[model samples]
Target chain A: MAEKPKAFGERYMVKPGKSFRLADCDPRAANGFSDKDAAKADTVRDAAAIDALQDKLYAEGKRALLVILQGIDCSGKDGTVRAVFNHCGPIGVKVQPFKAPTADELAQDYLWRVHHACPPRGFIGIFNRSHYEDVLVVKVRGYAPPEAIEKRYDEINAFEKMLSDNGTKILKFMLNISKDEQAERLTERIEIPEKRWKFNPSDLEDRALWNDYMKAYEVALTRCSTHHAPWYVIPADRNWVRNAAISRIVRETLEEMNPKYPEPKGWDPKTVKVV
Target chain B: MAEKPKAFGERYMVKPGKSFRLADCDPRAANGFSDKDAAKADTVRDAAAIDALQDKLYAEGKRALLVILQGIDCSGKDGTVRAVFNHCGPIGVKVQPFKAPTADELAQDYLWRVHHACPPRGFIGIFNRSHYEDVLVVKVRGYAPPEAIEKRYDEINAFEKMLSDNGTKILKFMLNISKDEQAERLTERIEIPEKRWKFNPSDLEDRALWNDYMKAYEVALTRCSTHHAPWYVIPADRNWVRNAAISRIVRETLEEMNPKYPEPKGWDPKTVKVV
Candidate 1:
C-alpha cells in the first residue's frame, strides 16, 4: 500500500478507552511544525481553508460542526476562535460560552444546556467552555459528589454519541498549557494595568487546585473520548502551535466531510443567459 | 450654567419611568455621523477607546461594566459584540450569551443564572441576549404563565438595582431593527445556505408574535431603564449604524466609569531606578 501524507493532529489525538495522561503532551513542544513562524504560516493557511470549507458546509446545510474547547483558565480557547474561525460569516458561526449553570440549567439534567447549544446542521458551533466543566470544575470544587461527578463521564460520552448520530460532527480540543505558562498569563493580568480587571483573586483559588483539576481532566479525557467524538490535547503554551494544530485538524475533518455546495436546479450556468 | 457638550448617546437613551417606543428611532438613519464610512471610522475609534478604558477598568478591579444586548432574533446582538468589543483581550472582556433556560435554570429564580455570569470587579462583560428574555420571549411565546411573567419586569429592575449598587455599571442596548428589516434578515437566513443553521424554523413562530414581543420589549425597556443602569434603543437595521451607535454608547459609558490604575506602593517608576 502507498504511504499517505502524514497528518499533523494524529500524534496529539487522545485514543478513546486508552489510559490518557495530561503530562504526556509537552505544551511547549511544536509537534508537527518546525518553527513558530512556520507554525503561524500553516495556521493562516489552514484557517483560510477552514473558512472556505465552512462556506461550502454552510451552503450544504445538512450537517453541522461542533467544536468543544475545554481547558483550564488560560488555555487559549478564545484565541483559537479568533485565529482559526473568525472569518466564517457571523451568521454561520455561533459561539456558546458556558459558565456556572443557571438555576434553570441545573434544574434539568446536566446536558440540558449542552443540548440547546449544539450547532444546528451546517453551522460551526464553538463551545468556549462546555459540559465537560461539569466534570473538571465540579470535581475539583466539590460542586458534585464524587460518585455523581464520576458518572458524568459516561453520560457525556453517550450524549456526544447521540449528537454524532444526529448529523453533528464533533471535535473536542483540550488546550494543554503548561503550569508555568498559566502562571505567566495570570501574572501578566495582575501586573499590566489594562489587564488588571481580568485578574480575579479567585483565580489563585483554582491555581491552588491545579493538581486536582489536572487529575479530573485526565479522567474525563480518558473515560469519555469516544470513536464518534474523540478528544485531542493540543500543546497550547505556544499560541501559534495551538492554532496551527487545531486548524489543521479542523480543515482535515471538514475535507473528510467533503461538504458539497448544493446544485442549482435544472442545469449548468453556461446554458443560462444573464439578464 | 453653560450647556455641556451634547452626549452622542443621550438621544437614544430610554428615559427612566417614561414610555419607550421602539419606533422612535430610525434604524437606517446615520444619526450623528455623516455617512456609513464615517460611522464605521467612529466605531473603530470608539472600539479603540473602549479597549483602553477596559484595560484601566480591569486594573482598577473595583467595579465592573456589564453591557446587555437584547433584541428579537436577527436584530444584530452577535454582530454588535463582534464590532464593538472584539478587539478587547478575551481574558479582559468576557461575553456571556444567555440562551433558553435549561431545566436546572428553570428550577431556580431566573436571576440565578444571570447573576452568576456577572463580570467581577474591573472586567467589561457583554451579555448577548439576557435576563430580559423572561419578559420578552417568555411573555410573547407563553414560555411562562402570564401572571408570573407580568411581575418579572419589576423583579428584573430590582435585581439590576442590586447589581448597580454593588458596583457593576450597566448599559443595556435594545437593538431596534425594523420589522421589514427583520423579515429581510430572516429571508436571507432561509435563502442563504450558510445562514440557514442560525435560523431556527421556530423563529417563524416568534415572527408570528412580533407585536407581542414589541410590547414586551417596550415595557422592559421603559420600566428597567433606571438612573443607575439605562437602556438605549439603538437603530439597528443598518449594520454600520448599529455598531457605531453601540460603540459610542459603550465608550462613553466606560469613560464615565473613569477606572484608574492603582498607585504603585512605596515606589514610582521615575523615583525608583532599576538596579
Candidate 2:
C-alpha cells in the first residue's frame, strides 16, 4: 500500500475529529493558502460565511453553542471574542467571565454558578475565562489544596459531559501566543498611551508562571476533549490567522449541528394566506 | 399657570419618561406615525445602537445593563425582543425568558436565579419575562397567598433599587395592549397558519383574567418605579408605537448616562503615533 498521504489542510478536506490541533494545520505556513494575499482573502470569505451561518442559527433557535477561550493573560482572548462575535446577534449570545469567585459564589459548588449562567437553548455562550480556573490558577497559586485541584479535573469532565448530553455544543480554544509575542504586545500597550489602561502590573507576575499555565492547559485539553466537546489548540501569534481559524472552526461546528427552524406539527402553509 | 397644557403627549418634547399612558401615544393615530410604525423604526435603531454599544462595553470590561420588558400576554414581549435586539452584538447581550418556575427555581428565593443571571458590567441583559412574574402572574393566578403577593412588591422594589444602585440601568416597559386590540390580534393569530405556533390554548384562559393582571401590573409599576430604576407604559395595541417608544427611552437613557469610551488615565493621544 502507498504511504499515508501527508495532511494538506488547504487542499484536503479536513474531517473534523473529536479534537483538533492548530499546529497540525499551521495556518501561517506559506503552503497553507498559497500566499499571504490568498490567505487574507480566504479569511474574509470565511468570516463572512461564519457570520451568515451564525445569523441563520440565531433565527432558527435550534441549537445552543458554548465557546471556551483559554489562554494566558494577554493571549488575545478579548480581541478574539470581539472579532469573532462582532457580527452575530446579541439577544441569543452572551459572554460570561469567570473571575475569582465571590463569597457567595464560593459558598456554592464550583459548577453551580456556571450552570446558572449556561446559555439557554438556541443561544451561544462564551466563557471568557472558565471553570478551568479552578484547576489552573487555583492550582498554580496554591489557592486550593493539591488534592482539590486534582479532583477538579474529574469534576470538569463530568460538568462538560453533562452539558454535551443536554444539547450544549462546546468548542474550547486555547490561544497559543509565544512569550516573545506577548512581551511585544504588552510593550505596545505601555508605549501607546491610548492602550495603557489595558495594562496591569500584576500580569507580569502571571507571565512568570507561563510554563505552568501551558502544562495546565495541555492536561486540561487532553483530559476533557471528547466527541461532543472538543478543544482546539489555536496558534494565536498572528491575529488574522487566529480569527480565520476560529471562524472556520465555529462555522464547521455549526454546520455539523445543521440547525433549522422547526415547523410546528400539522401546520399547513396553504391553509392561511398572509394579509 | 396656563391650564396645565391639556396633558396630551403631543404638547411634550417626547423626552423619554420613566412612566406614561398607552392611550396617549398610539402610533397608528393620524399623527405622523402610528404606534406600530414608530415602534418598528425604534426597534431597528435600538438594535443597531445596542450592537455598537455591546462591542465597546465588552472590550472595556465595564458594568452591565439589565433591561426588563413586562407586558400582558400577547402584548408583543417576544416581538419586541426579536425586533429591538435583532442586530445587537453577540458577546455582551443576553435575553432570558422566565417561564413557569421549575421545581428548582421555586426552591430558591424569588430573586436568587435572577441575581445570578445579571450581566457583568459593560454588558446588556434583557429579561423577556422577569421577577415581576411573581407579582403579576402569581397574583392573577392565585399561585401565592395574598399576604405573600403583597410582600413581593416591596421585595421587588428593593431588588430593583439594588440593581440600579450597583450600575445596572433598569428600563422596564409595560406594553398596554387594549382588550379590543388583543382580541383582534388573537383572531389574526388563529386565522394565520404561520402565527398559530405563537398562540397557546392557555392564552385564552389568561385573556379572560386580563383585569386582574392589569391591576397587578399597576401595583408593580407604582412601587418599582424609582429615581434610578423606572418603568415606561408602552402602547402595545400599535406594535410600531410600542417599539418606537421603548427604543427612544433606551436611547435617551444611554445619552443621559453619556457612555463614553473611558480614556486611559495618564494617556495622551497626541503623544502616541500609529505605526
Candidate 3:
C-alpha cells in the first residue's frame, strides 16, 4: 500500500520566487504542490519574506496602498486585518474605523473624511469600514436617496481610479462568513460571561437585515472592484485558514508590486570606510 | 569583570517571559528588557495576548479602558501607539485623535465629545490626543480664558475619576522627548526628501509655542495624576527606549489588573468533547 502523502511544508519548503496562492494549488495530487505539512512550512517561510518586503516598502517610501475592508455584521473584517498585517512594519501601517459620523463629518462629502485618513506614500492603510458604507449601509437602511446611492458607485470607482493614478494601490477584502458561523460566534458571545458585554441586542436586529446587507455588499463589490482597486472574497469560517489565506494574498500582492529600497542620492559609500 | 551578569536571554539562553514595562526600563540595556528590543518583542507577544484577552473581555461584557496619550508634538505618541499596539487583537482597540474641535465640538462642554468616545468596559481604547486638549492646546493657544482653562482641568480630573469609578482603567503616557531631540527629528524630516511630506510648515509655528505647551502639560499632569489613574512620564528620545518603556508599563498594568478568563456559568469542560 502506498503511504499517505506528507504535508506541503514537509515535502518542499517555500522559496522567495514562489507566488502566494496556496488555495489555488492542491498539495496532495501528483501534479499539485507539496502536501499540508509542506504548505505550513511554506507559510512560515512566506511570513519572513513578507516581513522583509514590508521593510523594503517602508524604506523606499514611494507609493502607498489603501486597503478597504467591508462586510456584514460579524463578518470578521477586523480580525482579518489584524492577522494579515500583524507581521508588517508599524511605521507604514494605519488602521481607521469609521463609526457613526459626527455632525462635522456629515456636513462634508462622504469621501472628505476618508481622504484625510489615506496613508502617506510607501505605507499601508486599512479602513476597517470605508466610504463603501455610504452606498451599502446607507442604501440598505434607506438613509440615502436612490439617485445618490447610484451616483456613489461611480464616485467610488472614479475615486479609486484617482488614487491608482496617484501611485496608490487599493485592495478591498470582503469577509464572507457563513451565516451558521456568524450565528455560532454570536451565540458564543451570549453564552460566555466575558463575551456577554460584546453582544448588542441590536446585532440581532441587524442579523434580521442580513440579506439586505448581503445584497448591498454584492452590489458594492461588483461596482467597486476595478482594476485599480480589486476586491477579493475571502471565506472566514476557520480563523487559521482566514489568516493564512489573507497573508498569502497580501504577500503575493507586495511581491507583485516589487517594492525596492530607494538609494540615497549622491552617497559615496567608498568614502565611508567599514572597519 | 562580572561575566556581564549572565545576560538573561543572550547568555542564559532562557526563553524570556513575554512582558515589559516602558516607563522605567532602558530599552538598550543588555537584557531583552531594553527599551527598543523589549518594545518590539512585547508587541508581538502582547498582540496575541491582547487578541485572546479582548475576545474574552468582549464575551464577558465588561467596561472598556480609555488610555489617553498626551505629549508635545513630535514627542512620539503616535509612533508609540503604532509600535506597541500594532498587533493588539481586533478592532477592539480604537484610537481617537482629538484635533482642534469643530464648531459643534466647540459649542459643547469640553468633555461632551470625549464622553462619547470613551470605550465601554471590556475594550481597550486609546486617545492619541484627548479631552486634555481642551486644557493643553486650547489654553496654550489662548482659545479659552485663563479661569476657564483652570476650570477645565478640574472638570477633566472629575471626568477621569468617574470613568475609573465605572471600571475604566486610564493609562496616560506623556512621551517626554527633550527639545533638542525634537529639533533633531524635525531637521531629519526636512532634510530627507522621502520625509518632506511629514514636515508641515505649520509645525514650526507650533514648535515656537513649545514652552507654553510644556507649562500646560505640567499643570495637567499635576492636577490629573491620581491614585486611581496616573500619568507616566516616558522618555522618548530613543525610539527603541520609548517603545520598550511603554510596552513594559502597559504589560505590567494589564497584568496587575489580573483580567481573568470568565467561565460560562453552567458549561462543563469535561462534558465538552471534540466531535
Q: What is the DockQ of each candidate?
A: 0.07, 0.26, 0.11
lDDT of 1: 0.81
What interface RMSD does each of the candidate structures achieve? 8.8, 6.4, 9.0
- Candidate 3, residue B106: Cα displacement in angstroms equals 2.5
Residue-level lDDT of model 3, residues B211-258, one tens digit each, is 788777766776766655667666667777666656656665665566
- Model 1, A1-275: lDDT tens digits are 11122276568878766887888879988786778888788888887788789878877889999999998888888789878875553445777789888898889988899898898887888899999999988888988889998788888888988898888988999999988899888767656655554445567789888899899888888897777888899989989889988999999989888998775444333342211
**Tens-digit lDDT string for candidate 2 (B37-142):** 5546656877677666655565566566788888776789867765666556455567777889889989998888888778778777888888989888888899
lDDT of 2 by residue, A1-275 (tens): 11122232222222233343333544233334345566556666765666666555665665688998888877888777766765564555677778889999999988889888787777778898888888788877888789878888778877888888887888888777877888888778767654666766667777888778767766676676655566666767787677766766776777767776445455444453322
- Candidate with the greatest DockQ versus the true structure: 2
Best prediction by TM-score: 2
TM-score of each candidate? 0.64, 0.71, 0.60
lDDT of each: 0.81, 0.68, 0.66
The complex in candidate 1 yields a DockQ of 0.07
What CAPRI-style quality would you assign to candidate 1?
A: incorrect
> Sorted by TM-score, highest first, which candidate order results?
2, 1, 3
The lowest-lDDT stretch of 10 consecutive residues in candidate 2 chain A is A1-10
Task: Write the residue-wise lDDT of candidate 3 on A163-203 in tens digits.
Answer: 88887877777666766777878777676666655456656
Distance from true location, Cα of B185 in model 3, Å:
1.2
